[model samples]
Target: MKETAEAYLGRPVSKAVITVPAYFNDAQRQATKDAGRIAGLDVLRIINEPTAASLSYGMDRKEGLVAVFDLGGGTFDISILEISGGVFEVKATNGDTFLGGEDFDNALLQHLVDEFRKEQGIDLTKDRLALQRLREAAEKAKCELSSTSQTDINIPFITADATGAKHLSFTLTRSKFETLVNPLVERTRQPCKDCLRDAGISAKDITEVILVGGMSRMPKVQEVVQEIFGRQPSKNVNPDECVAMGAAIQGGVLRGDVKDILLLDVTPLSLGIETLGGVFTRLINRNTTIPTKKSQVFSTAADGQTQVGIKVLQGEREMAADNKLLGQFDLVGIPPAPRGMPQIEVTFDIDANGIVHVGAKDKATNKEQAITIQSSGGLSDSDIDRMVREAEQYAGKDKERKALIEARNDADTTMYSVERSLNEHKEKLPSDVVEAVQAAIADLKGSLEKDNLEEIREKISAASRHHSRLARPCLGKRAAAARLLLGGRPEEPRKRSMRRRSRGTYAESNSQVVVRVRCIKLFGPWEGQDHEIGVRHSCCLIAVTGIQSCTAVSIWAGVLH
Candidate 1:
């Protein structure tokens, strides 16, 4: 089975969805998924056999009831659905988890042995060889009865005791076959009626019904179905090919080809856990949609209890042992305290593909603990790399946003400091000095408020140099006042020495050198509203401070405005 499954999956496939019987165990499910992985196929999803069949039959219909009575060799499932606008919505589903068409053929084989015993007094009840041959004959007749009005089953076989061989043949008419298979067909009648009742509708509401699976090919099965639904079933989709085709459609959806339709599947069973005093705490009910999140809060019942144990189950049973265990958890370090002191909140998140994640938090400390849900949907290395790259791009955007915010804040701070200083020094400073300073601060703050971060930064930077200009005039006035009040001789103002030095072959790293040059320019008379220039050297860097910029005109001490 593994090799066959591998070979089938290895052929050039874009995507695929594997289907298995609903009653399969965990080990069987794992083997099938592993086999698909080994074949290098991108298995998109796994669907239940019966549900897949319904999709294949109802994908084309805009609205109808498709009764998928699947009786395969080893498994039986009956799913009734209502389709509308390309949505295959399930109305109700029921099944004899152990019964199938093979079981029906086996029952007929037993009947044959009973008749042979009464006619000849030769019992072959303990004969595996005889039973195996009878099975083959029953299967052949069951297939033939579907088309012909009547079919005969003839078997020429050897005796089990090696005494002799005998011929056992019987004719089965369609009417008589209905009488024989009435019991098998009757089991579905109540389930269908219950389905209609639970779905809150009558058979009259269903426009057209569909039949899926090979067992529905029987003429007697068709009669019972028509009598039950009060209408003829649809034959637009083939029974045998429906399931695979439906799986293919789902595979296309996973690959993003068929996106207009959505399949909102439900959990197969109730999910809950046993709580204190042996009471069951229900987390999710049956038929609940997948990819959901639910939470439960708990607290310590007694002092010194550092942990709370959680045992999860997936069945309607009240007892934990009676239900199937999905998983368990422990809320560690719950803290030592009085009864009902530490609060522990637990969250359960189940994803669309039937995977679950658990989280716990301590309410007292507000600390969180998260359980990593094991996933079948793990990304490849390249996908991880791409995700990291996208994350880095977002980080860059965040940094840029912060930088812009900081720039505006700095502009605001600078304007605040400058405005306060201008108001306090208005008495000593000139009117133009105070007004110019106030105007610059106003423009800078207004720009910052309007999200003009770059312009704010530049204006603030320009005003930063104006700080010295403001301080120079204010200090000059204070100095003149102090000298006059003290009746003291004023010291000579410092001057900057200017010089031109040529490049040399030698360079000094530690040596200190200072040079001073003095240029004295005396104006003869005022020419063209200009004055002569006078320069002096100083020991430090010198800056020309004024409220207006002065330019040289006709080699005279220029125009100022």
Candidate 2:
């Protein structure tokens, strides 16, 4: 992928933001980063694939809640997001990593194999070539069924019987295909409902629903999404490339080419530890926003227990034994206190990558221990360190390249802004100031054509200074106008009074002025209209009359004497 991107762009692509399954754990995420590094790309971030899909559809520019249903070749992911102010925040995400389009193909393949065996008395599943042929045919048929009512699955020389090679031909209809894979498509329904429930939103509340991944093109999958969400799924983004597009958008954001876009992802599962009585105690619940930290105080269950075992678990189960064990560590040197006396603060810190860091602190001793749970499985520290070192080896060159790109981007943006300002305010500025601004812009533009980053930066700075100098007069005019709109300026203090009123009835219209006024500005211009009012009569209303407008801009109101 890195090579292809670089080749297409005709440039060296050193940094990238890769998208992964929203439900991917730490190990899977790390493995992706590692792969990027191996390909000579600095992995800037690991974003959720569904979130990327949302970006592809430009959903961040819209408001309200959205759902991204992604069913890829080998996995399924559903993400519920709240979009506002160019921010896409994943409220909840859920998926089965092993379930996807491949499953449907497998289902069809099983049926075909069974029928072939029954018809020709030849079990071809054991033959690699025959099985591969059948699998490919099944995949093609599945895709064709999505668009048409029926398709033919035919393969000659599918396998050899005791006599010779045999041919397998079958007519697969859309209804039959749906029937075979309906269970697999239906599997996503509960997860969609669960994700919505976790997000505290109802199906009707979703303003837009996006479908991504190649499998989402399946008619059955689209029907399921529409049925569950009560609206036709949005096909605004290409099913196969939306995730990549989103990743590219993220890369642009990192490079400052894109602005005001934010992504807030969530942890896919609950993370906690085993407590006393073999129960699971959750610290960070599933679907909670990422880069979150929570600490809970735990105590020894037995008297004089100096050591405590902390077994970290992940899942939605109530019992520790039922959940997946992530990792475990022990806390020692507790000073032999009674059960529940020593305060052991177990802290769960899940970073933006959704990787968890578990820490235990003995309050009395101020000693702490921390462990990073490997979500992918038993990857040792050495393996990670090696990958880190390998990635760092390219850091120097990549850093220089990144600096050059940034300098160029900065130069281009500054030149554009300066040019625009020069055009907009040239009439208000001195002739020499405009000339200097134009000269600076020309110099900056010239520097952009060169390979010298330092020269480009210097020109950018000089151009910005010139632009600021030219903008001073226009800025001063704007400031003076703003002052005229507010109040001209403050003047000497003078006394004033404002009447108090109660209920609408005349009997209760008279009320005490219990508050004091310090200074007030009446509506409209106040070049010399400032006034300072002293405390009014305690129980009698004092109405401040006169002034041009009815509204008063009180700078200070306090208790009266």
Candidate 3:
């Protein structure tokens, strides 16, 4: 996939921001990053899937609370976010990693298997190949029912018995399909409720609800979402592509292609250490924004304690044994004191990457020990280093290819912009200038065909020069012609307090006419100041607004009393 992207972009792509399910733990996120590194990409950030969907919907530009309901093939996640001034901050997130459209398919498959077994007096589940076919048919029927009221599922020669070849066939109605998956749909409700409660907001506070992932397309799922949020789900974005689009948007922000938007994701589970009596002590609660730190001081469980053990755990469970143990370390050399006499400060710190660091300090001695909880289920450092070394061996060839692609892209952009400008202002521009720009555009196009980086760059420079020279007196003739047609004689420009404001006056048979013009060039040498053009007599006041280019003017005139 990396090679394919590089081929299509005409460049060597290296950096990326990957999206993962919001419920993924530290180990899962690390595994995803390791996969990217193995693919020769420098993973910049790991964002949540639902958060990325919101970005694709441009929720960052809106101000309000939003709920993202994401139901994919094998997982369901609900996240509540507050968006204000291009900042998307996730307040809470909840999901079932084992629940999704796949479960729905399985439900339908089981129904089919039961029906066939009852009819044929033989359980199709015993046949592996037949069961596989049934599973596929069930999935297809489920998808078909999403758009239609009913669908027919038929697999010829699916199985055989003493009665010769047998065929499996059935018609599944949408209502029946809904019935089969209603239980699975109900599972999503509790998560939404949990997330809303965690965010400290009610359903009424949510301004918009966005549905993402392929499973969100089901009518039953949409109905459930509407019932939960008290409004129709937003259909502005494609359910299947929004997550990927959001990731691309994030990538643009990191590359400086986009600006102003900020994303603040949260840790899915709590981080803490074990305390007295095997109890779990939470320092950082679940759904808390990351890159944060919390500390609490505890006394020794035993008298004359000289050392304390810090067992880092993650979860919502109350017992240390029930939670996931991330790492453990002992902080020794503590002053021997009576129980409850010494203060042991245990601090839990989580960085932006969602990695946790636990530190313990003795208040009396100021002696501290810390441990960084490493990701367990991913490649080791030695494996990553070997993969990186293998990739670097081809760096020279990749560099040359990247240089050529960049040069060609720059040349193409320059040619298009210059040609578009010339075409737009052709009538106002001198014929010679128009012809010169067209020639430069043609040269640039020809150089692109040769794929010569140096030649293409030279052509781009030449085209830019012609494009820059297009700012010469293009609008003066038109302004003068309009003034003459209005039956007024051009008068000498009169100085005004504002350098950009100028007035012209002409005499008609019955009334003295005045014309005022202010031209503010948005770009080039005349960017900051405005130019005044004279106009002939008219018994009206003309106001021009949004003066973007000297070559184009929009005038709104009103009759004077």
Candidate 4:
């Protein structure tokens, strides 16, 4: 990252604000900071991926409740935030760090491999290169099907059979692909509901929904989001570039290049310590706003307990042993006292950088121990220096190897998708389209054998562009037919309904107009009910259905007008 920045700016770069998964624990976050230092970059702060994506979206807009749904290559994060006055305050965040687009690709890959093995009696999974090729093909097919209703997956000489060599070829339609990944996408629903519950808001209350990450481009993902939120997800920002744009925005905030923006993030997990019977007692709860402090008092459990053991932990589990131990310290030299007599205060302070500082004080003796905790599972300074020197030494060679692998991987994916398109649409495609696609495929294949990674990348991108262009008409036709089936129009936006009613004991109306607003509880003990109020004048009431509690007009009545 440092080298990339330096090369791009034509100057030395030394500082960065990195983004990580919302579910990353303290160890993972610390590891990220250490990695930044290893790359010769000063880590300013660690931010959450969903939060960063939200920052990107809220940069140009203000005053909306947004739910950020980010589905990346291997992780899914959902964050609910209230944006107002240039402040992005996260209400709740939930995610599955292991769930992402890779899972979709793997599901398709497994299906293809099974089909190939059954027909040709060849298990492609037994060969690493064959499996890798199939994975590339599967990912490309997935991406292509996002824009088109149907796509082909074709890999030449993917594996060897008893006869000689065999190729894997198959047709994947959008419907079938949706079936394959729908279950995986469905996995995000629970988290969304959970986030709403945590935020004390309903899905209907969210004013805007933002989708980010590469996988967010999938039409199926958009549909699922709409089904859950009852609103269309915002397409104003690019899913792939939004996070980086947000990080850059955050960097600007740090350098004072940007103004009037405030970011408030939360800790992903609870921070606590062990108490009596090894029970975990939390001081700072998960999702609590940071640059915050919380302290809990404790008494020694054993008789004549003089010293208290402070073991810092992180996680939501009840048992201290089941959670991750962040760090530990001891408070000693206390006046000997019976059980439950000594007053020991343990305070946890998490700063802006998200690093923790623990302080333990004995009120009787006024003795204190303050420790700046780096990490319980982080590498030491010497280890970081060693790794950095080693990386610097081997940087050139590693870059070449990485670039070559990436180039080959991209070329393989593009060629497979292009070949699939050519095979399935050959009869219907224009002659020029057919010739151009075939030539592009051949050129990409030829570039794979050369040592030039840049050339390989260019050929792969060119082939992908041609394939998308040829497939666009088919996708358009499918979309048009669906629109026609749905009354030749797109879904209309829902409007909030408001009504006016005259308020009187005998229902008498006057020449004056008045407004009133009421809300009702939709579920639970007070379900299907409205608040009763004394009628006094002609009024208008805007009854919002999705908010949590039922309420009558108060001082808010005058403001509604």
List runs of model 1 lying over 4 Å from the truth: 1-10, 13-15, 21-35, 38-41, 64-67, 80-82, 122-125, 160-163, 174-181, 299-304, 318-321, 338-342, 355-561
The count of residue-pair clashes in candidate 1 stands at: 6
Candidate 4: clashing residue pairs, number: 3
Q: Sorted by TM-score, highest first, which candidate order results?
A: 4, 2, 3, 1
lDDT of 4 by residue, 380-441 (tens): 88999998898989999888989899889867766765665566556657788889888998
User: What lDDT is obtained when candidate 2 is compared to the true structure?
Assistant: 0.76
Name the weakest run of 10 consecutive residues (lDDT summed) in model 2: 547-556
Q: Mark the regions of model 3 whose C-alpha exceeds 4 Å error after superposition.
A: 1-4, 364-366, 375-379, 386-561
C-alpha TM-scores of all predictions: 0.58, 0.67, 0.66, 0.70
Best by TM-score: 4
Residue 162 of model 2: what lDDT?
A: 44
lDDT of 3 by residue, 487-548 (tens): 43544232222222233323332232333433232323222322333222321222122211
lDDT of 1 by residue, 1-561 (tens): 334655888754544588866444323444555455544445567666766877776666556665666666666665656677777666555555566677667667667777778755667666545566667777887888788888765543323222323446566776776676678777767766765665567777767666666777877677777887788877877878888788888887887888666665555456665677766677876555566788887776677888877766666677777776655667787668886877777777765544456777888777777653322344444555565566556877867778889987677656654554455445667878777877777777677667656787888887665543455464453443333333434453432432343311212223212322221232322212222222211111112121111111222111110
For model 4, the local distance difference test gives: 0.77
Clashing pairs in 2: 27-376, 494-532, 497-544, 498-544, 499-543
lDDT of each: 0.60, 0.76, 0.77, 0.77
Segments of candidate 4 deviating more than 4 angstroms: 370-376, 389-561
Clashing pairs in 1: 495-537, 495-538, 496-537, 496-538, 497-537, 497-538
